[model samples]
Structure formats: structure tokens, C-alpha cells
Target: MRTIESYLRMLLIMTLCYLIAEWVIDEPKGTVLFNPYVLGFLFFIFLLVISFEVIIGVLERIADQLTTPEQRVALEEAKKQKALENKWKKRFAEWLIGKQTTPEAQLILEDHNYDGIRELDNPLPPWWLYLFYLTLIFGVVYLGYYHLFGGSDQKQNFEQEMAMAKEQIETYKKTAASFVDETNVTVLTDASSLESGKSLFEIHCAICHQNDGGGAIGPNLTDNYWILGGDIKSIFLTIAKGGRPGKGMIAWNNSLKPQEIQQLSSFILSLNGTTPQNPKAPEGTLINQ
Candidate 1:
């Protein structure tokens, strides 16, 4: 029960941290609430916090197992004695310096006396020197990792990713043409094809044509009037060829398979007479029902 409670608490903390991080990063953008980068960063921060808590908790548990109450008391007493000895040593050193008039002590002191100013040359603390050395070691490790695997250089990573994507796209195009042959493409009016077409349209086309086929960048498909044509073949041809030059619709012949195009044409035909908000003014010949 305690373990379950801990897990639940951790989950709640992580959720709260994510919400806070998301809110902080998304403060500038008021219109759209969901930002992928913000969400990713929030998730990363939550994971980091969880990792830190787990590591510390594990270390504490290990420490508890290693040290008994008696051992802890002994350790504390030893630390106290060491601190007292250090304090006495400092006081003795100060007293000895006050009484120092020897040639060695005089030589150690500088003679640039102004009012009551004195300077002493002290060696760097051993702990500070060790810390400096550790910092240099850390720097070397960071540099090696970043150069080898992290790809800290943004331009290089961007170019590499772009190259990879381009290669993949080329391979896809080569395989795609076999399935999207223009000559062998047949019109689809079947229910299964129409459903597939609807799914594809929702994922790829809805951004421009909208969910209800109300046009934003593309023409409305629901009304009888069409921009290119209302007939299935003409619609398929227009989709294959794209809109008139410079009208923003690119030839989807490369992106979509021939059968998929037929399905999309069927789906468009299925949308006839469906109502949508802000439909564009009728532009093509009105196909009589």
C-alpha cells in the first residue's frame, strides 16, 4: 500500500510538473493551446525530476543500510573533533603570525605598507584545485560526447536529416509509381474504397478542404457546382493534374496511388449535396442531379 501510494504521488507530481512547464512555455501563444515542443519539454522535465528523486531515494536507502545508529553517532563525533582541531589550528596560526619577527617571516611579508594594508601569498586550497581538475575532466567528456554522438552542431544535423528524408522520399516515389499508374486506374464507388478514401482525406486533405468538405484553400466538394468538374473521371483527372498553374494545388500524382485517387474521387462524389459552413461561391458547371 505504501509503495502504491508513493507511485501515485510520483505520478501526480509528474503530471503537475508537466502542466506547469506546459503553461510556462505556452504563455506567449494565446490562440492555440497545444504545442508539440512545449509538451515534449514538459515531459522531459517531468522525467528528469522523477529520475532525480529515484536516484536520491536509492542512495538514501543504501546509506541507511550501510550505517547503523551507533556508526552514525561515531561519525558525527569524529567530524566534530576534526572541526574543533581545525578551529584551534587556525587560532594558533594567527597567534604565531602576530609574534613572528624572524627573517623568514619578514621575507614572507611584503613591504608595500600604506596606512595598515598587508598582503599574504597563500597557495590554492587542495579542494579547490581538485574541483578545477574535475571541471576540466567533465569538459573533455562533454566535448567528446557532443562531437561524436550528440550532434551539437545544428546545421550539420539539419543537413543530415534533410538528406535522409530526401533519400527515403525518393525510395517511396519509386515504389509508389507501380501502384499509382494513370492508365490502369479505375473509378471506385465501392463502400470499402470510399471509407479508405474518407480516412485518407481526413488525415491529408482535411487541413485544406476541412472536415465537412467546406473549402479553405481547396474548393468545396459538397455542392453540385465544381471548380474543375463534377464528374468522377474529371475530378480524378483534375486531382492527378492539380489545379490550373499557380492556383496552389500541386499534382498529387506522385503522392497518391491510382487506386487511392479513384477512392478519393468516389469519396468526393459521395459528398454531393452535403452542407458545410462557409462554402466557396460555385465556380464550375452545375451537374444536374
Candidate 2:
């Protein structure tokens, strides 16, 4: 039994429930109204709704007490309107479920019988049937487009994205800071880059190589002896990819950009034959040869 009055009350109840939930999650324990403005706004709304309901109740009570003959007739009309609304609600519910039969329609009863029971001749709802047909059509289109017609699938899209990303990276390398491996590296002779490389080395690499690339826990970088290779490309590869495990050198490629690594290689190479305080004894094949 629903009336416009009942619907408005339901909305009021729902608003109160939402406000209660808001008050709970908003503030943590021991923190007073974490956001005073928002909580205060909610409180104001609550008071407004309560005051509105009180005013409505008082007006309704006054109208009941002051009812005249015309007002009584209007009240009866309102009751008829409520009954009409209920009748429509019932009809709509039956239509939506697609399972209602009028008493006069005896022709729809089926011949199939079990004991004293008989089934009704009923078809599925038209809306449900149309929705099913739409889904089937969509399925066929999807299958043909993605598979038979060679449209891009998830794997193809992923691979295409990866290829595009790789191409963009290569283009950027050509225009900006280019990548350097052992095959393409050469000693950078400029003083500014060398100074930058020196600074980068001291900050990120000085722990094991010492403050001056003199080498303490790692090989002596100043001497002619080379643990890995001593050429520019060799030094670049060694520094970028690191030496073998237990050699105390980790890859700097992840931390430093390719151009910066190139500068680092040149700086280390420039330090060759330079004297260091108590330099570690040279350990590999002589590279100054």
C-alpha cells in the first residue's frame, strides 16, 4: 500500500541512513570531526530534514481538525486515487512477469494434465526474447570481426603497442640521448661532460671505487691493468652492465641514463696512469700496451 506520503517518508529514511554511514567512515577514532566543514554540512542537512518533517506533520494534523464537508469529499477523492494507483501497480507487475491470465481467457489452458493439474499455454516475454536475440547477434559479430576478419585481438594490440613504444624509444635515442653499448662507445673528450661524469661517479659509484676511481674494494681504475677491458667501449659495457658476480660492481644502466654512462666511461678512461694515494695493486691483463 503506497501513497505519495509514504514515498516521501522512504526518501527521508534513506537520507538519514546515508548520513549515518558518512559520519562513520569520515573520522578515525580519537580524531574529532576530521573534516569539520563536511560533517557540519551533513549535520545541517539532518536538522533541515527533521524540521521539514515536523512542519509537515503539524500541517497534516491541522488540516484533519479543520475538515469541512468539501474537504471530506476531497479526502474521499484522494482515497479513490490511491486505489487506482494500486490497481495499476498490480497490472504492471503482472505484465512485467508475463505470467498473468484473466478469468475469461479459458482458451489458454493446455491439454497436458497430471492427476488434477494442467499447465497454461504461455510464451516467453517479448522483451526477454528480443534481448536474447540481440545478444546472439552481438556474439556472431564479435567472433567474425575479431577472428575471421583479422581484426586486432588483445595479443595483437599488446604487441603493436610494444612495437610502437620500442620505435618511439629508438627515435628518441637518435634525436636526444643515444644509447651506448660496447660496439658503439667512444671516449668523450669534452671537459664539461667529463666533469659531470666525475660528479656522477663520486655520488653513485664512490662507495666501492673510492672517491677518485682509485679502486679499493674493486679493481684499481688508475693503473694500466684491466680486470675487464680497458678500451672506451669495454669500459662502457662493464660499467653499464656490470662485471661478473662477486666482482663488486653492479649495473649502473638502470640508475644512469645511456649518455651519462657514456660520459662516465670517458671519465674513467681519462684517469688512466694518474696517481692515487696507496692505489690497489693492478690485477688483470695490462691494457696500456
Candidate 3:
């Protein structure tokens, strides 16, 4: 039970450390910045490190718990002997190497050398050698998934999706246009339709036309003056096809559906007699009657 509690406490400390590391690594970049992707990556790495620590800790606790008192004493003695043996071996190797001439010393050196300094052809420690080999294998697997299997290049994928979305919107507009007839230009005098039109206009058209349709950038639609035309169909056409080329008004036919243009034109008709705070001076022909 004590061992279990100790392990839990250690795990808690490790978890807190992981969280701190993640927070430090993923902190905001700019003066008031935030980055979700960096935060997410930090969280992922944190989880991996915590998992490794927990597994190793649990295994160590179990091994310690299983050891008998006598066995523990014997194990300590064995460890001391092992340490002494390693120390002597290192000393012997250094002594033997020191006795050799520099030219003779190069005979036992490996082919790889750095700046005339040659590495001794000593065998790698087993643990380090295994870890190095495992890392190589991990690299191959990571490369296969992230590069070869298209795990990366998310920006390219997003651009492709945007293009596809644009294409679908164009296709829908074309299909909606085919359904329009002369009678489709119904006046939105009904309260419900006018309210709906107001909402849509506020979201999509308010920036240019102003909320009350007393235009800011585009021509004012309140007074009976037709930059394109004042009639329902002409209004619909103007709004749908947009104003003249190089004009600030873009082609709404691409952005808005044909039905939306009809509703918007109806809304404009409703605002014919209404006044706004800053009405642009009337342009185009004045429709008398």
C-alpha cells in the first residue's frame, strides 16, 4: 500500500511537471497572442511523456515489491560489484591506450574520425545501442505516415476544400437561376418576408448598402431613382448581376442565390419612402410615379 501511494504521488508530480512543460512550450507568442496548434502539439507530447513515466514507474514499483529482504541485500551487493568491475575495466582500457604510441593507437580506431581525432572501436553499451536502433525504426515509421501517406500538407488540403466549396456554390447558383421566371420577382410587402429580408440584408449587404438601404457605397434605393432601374425585375437584375465593371459593387450572383436577390430587391422596394441618417445624394434617372 505504501509503495502504491508513493507511486501515485510520484505520478502526480510527473503529471504536474508535464503540464508545466506543456504550458511553457505552448505559451502565447505575441503581445496578446494565442496559438491552438502549438498548444495541441504540446498536449500530445505531454501525454506521451507522462504515459512513459507512469509505465516505467509502475514496473519499478512491482519489481521492488516482489523482492525479498535477503534478495534485496544480495542485489545491492551485486550492484556494488558490478560498479567496481566497470570502474576497473575503464581504468584498464585507459592504461592500455596510454601505453601505445599515437600512430599505433590509430590502428584500433574506427574508420569514422573527426578533425584528426579517431574514435576507438569499442562496442556500444547494450541499452544505448538498442535505443539508437529503435529510434531509427521510429524515424522510418514517422516519415512513412507524415510525408508518404499525406499526414502533412494540411494547408494544401484546406485550399483544395475551399476550391471545391466555391465550385459547389457556383453550381447551386446556376441551378437556382434556371428556376426563375417573370413572376418570381414577387414584392416582399408581407411582414414575415420583409423581416427575413432585413436579417439577410443586415448580414451580407449592410456594409455597403447600410442597414436602412440609404446607401453608403452603392446608390441609394429609397428614392425612386434607378441607377440600373427602379422596377422589381430591374432591381433584381441589378442586385443579382451587380453594378457596372470596376464599380465597388461585386457580382452578387456568385455569392447570393437567385431567390435571395429577389427577396433583397423586395426589401429595397419596401424602403422606397424611408429615410436614413446619411443618405448619399440621389444618382441616375428619377422615376416619376
Question: Could you say which candidate leads in TM-score?
Answer: 2
Q: Model 1 Cα displacement at 197 (Å)?
A: 0.4
Model 1 C-alpha lDDT per residue in residues 175-256, reported as the tens digit of each score: 7765544444566778899899999889878888887788888888898887787777777888788889998777888998
Would you list the C-alpha lDDT of every candidate in the order shown?
0.74, 0.78, 0.74
Q: For model 2, state the Cα shift of residue 173 in Å.
A: 1.8
Which of the predicted structures, 1 or 2, would earn the higher lDDT when compared with the native?
2
How accurate locally is residue 33 in candidate 3, as Cα lDDT from 0 to 100? 21
Q: Candidate 2 residues 1-289, lDDT tens each?
A: 2343555565777567556656666556435344666567657766776687777778877988899989889998998898688887656544545554567465788888899799867777655777889999999999999879999989989999999999997787677645666667778999999999899889988788877778888888888899788888788888889999877798888988878999988989888888877688888998654
lDDT for residue 28 in candidate 3, whole number 0-100 = 54
Q: Tens digit of lDDT per residue, candidate 3, span 1-289?
A: 2344455555676567556655566455341123566456556755776687678779988998999999999998998788687886546544433332456655777887789987786545455667889999999998998889977577988999999999997777568755552345667678877787788899988898898888888878788877887888888877787779988877788888766777788888888988887888898999974
Sort the predicted structures by lDDT, highest score first.
Answer: 2, 1, 3
- Lowest-scoring 10 consecutive residues by lDDT in candidate 2? 1-10
RMSD of 3: 12.4
Alpha-carbon RMSD of each model: 15.3, 9.2, 12.4
Q: Output the worst ten-in-a-row residue range by lDDT, candidate 3.
A: 26-35
